[model samples]
Target: MTFNIHQDYSEDTGIRHSKYSETSGEDFYHDKLNEIFYGCYTRNEVLELVLDGGDDGYTPSFLDESIGNLVYDFTLDVVKTMLHIVSDWEPYWIDEIEKKTYPKWEERRRKGEQATITKSHGAWYRLINGVPEKRVWIVYTEEQ
Candidate 1:
């Protein structure tokens, strides 16, 4: 079954316009795709469209960007849940989430750093779906 985020859930058109339609950053999806990204995990179609509203699918770079944001808004586990919910609770979404997006979330979630990112880099970053992010050497410099 082909999925159309805009047409399928017209009830949320207002949200599709304001929240999901923004293009500036991640975490923008923020729990919406809890019912949004099933297509990417199961069927085949637009990943970002459901969030950022467009008519495109799976460009290497776009896929990369969308994955990061999707993990941020909905953890790999949650994305899996969303997909399964659409699949009548089937578990195949597990394979897709595990292969495509889970490792990054797992490594960070275990380390317990999502809170750090939320506090320190919250303005610049879109926090890690309540999980830790890849650790990095953050250096803030001041010049005279």
Candidate 2:
């Protein structure tokens, strides 16, 4: 089964930005750490479901064994510690265009000039704030 993980950020202006990632149930269970971070599932929820043999309809039955094994391999404290190591993550561009791109985009928007912005290339994972994150660069162009 495919699961969509979404992250949202809200600005002071009340505008919200959302980012999403799609992962298979197998991959999701394998990673485990992101279960809580991505808000897909919480460690407590997994533990309760597996231990109590209860179903909330969120976790797929096929992943039960994998989730059980993951719980068995590590204690809750250990999982918490591991999660702390990588507190959060964000998308980033591999080309590292933030410095140049943001200023130009802001200037264009400020001046009410016509412009086009695009992003391409595979997201490269990197470390930021002691967390592993995917990076995506921007391609900016002026409208003719």
Candidate 3:
């Protein structure tokens, strides 16, 4: 089945907003086509450009910026869903552990004493609650 993906351009706000239609099995292909036509870059092409350094040297293009934003939004959603799943399982694990070990573990976790998971992106997640608590960007400087 064919689906329609609309890109609305707002003149007042100067923003392009995408409206997607729900499609069952062909959603992946549809989304890729939308990205290529509206966003001007496919995910695989963006990855290839980054890995191959753009066939020669680095040259900035509109496609690069567009794909970068799309990647960021997509990754943020994935991370949020993962955090939700982990958080949902926390109470079950805590209950199981309390039956065997000290009950004060939950109390300590409530007081924000839980361990954190750190990622290369400088994002930190609380292990007990699975909340994305902090994000820090590391800036690199080249020395002459």
Candidate 4:
């Protein structure tokens, strides 16, 4: 839905401000779309809203940025979920152990000694429903 920027903003002034007054056309929607994006929803729900070929909340200007962030977050969540599934119970213990044993394990491996790495067992779950732990992903590219 288009936001009515012309609505009365200040009672004392009775002045209606246009969103265009502050930012360019593109940026105005970017800000608005980002506002809706911060709400808690499953990755799938957000993706469906943005890309499932529907008019439901799909604003033209902010489409690219919102879609990009949504895709990145969804991919991260999927990977995290898969890792948790593969590890089964180990993810739980790994999440809890308040220690970084990676260095020691690497040292042992470098010394030609087989080191048993300990991983915690547990499922990966969101602390708050619908919010991802982090919004970061790595892209690996190969040179031809």
- Backbone clash tally for model 3? 0
Ranking by lDDT: 1, 2, 4, 3
What's the distance in Å from true for residue 37, model 4?
2.3
- Estimate the TM-score for candidate 1: 0.33
* Steric collisions counted per model: 0, 6, 0, 11
Task: For each candidate, give its TM-score against the true structure.
Answer: 0.33, 0.20, 0.17, 0.21
Among the numbered candidates, top TM-score falls to 1
Which parts of model 3 are misplaced by more than 4 Å? Answer: 1-50, 60-64, 72-144
Candidate order by TM-score, decreasing, is 1, 4, 2, 3
Worst window of 10 by summed lDDT in candidate 4: 8-17
What lDDT tens digits, residue by residue, belong to model 2 across residues 70-106? 2323333333333221111322210122233334434
TM-score of 2: 0.20
lDDT of 3 by residue, 1-144 (tens): 121112121111111111221221122222342233222222222211111211222112222222223223233222222211111322443233224222333334335442211111233222223222233322223320
Evaluate model 3: give its TM-score.
0.17
Off by over 4 Å in 1: 1-3, 6-28, 34-54, 59-79, 85-97, 115-144
The total of clashing pairs for model 4 equals 11
Worst 10 residues of 3 by lDDT: 9-18
Error of 3 at 115 (Å): 37
Error of 4 at 39 (Å): 1.3
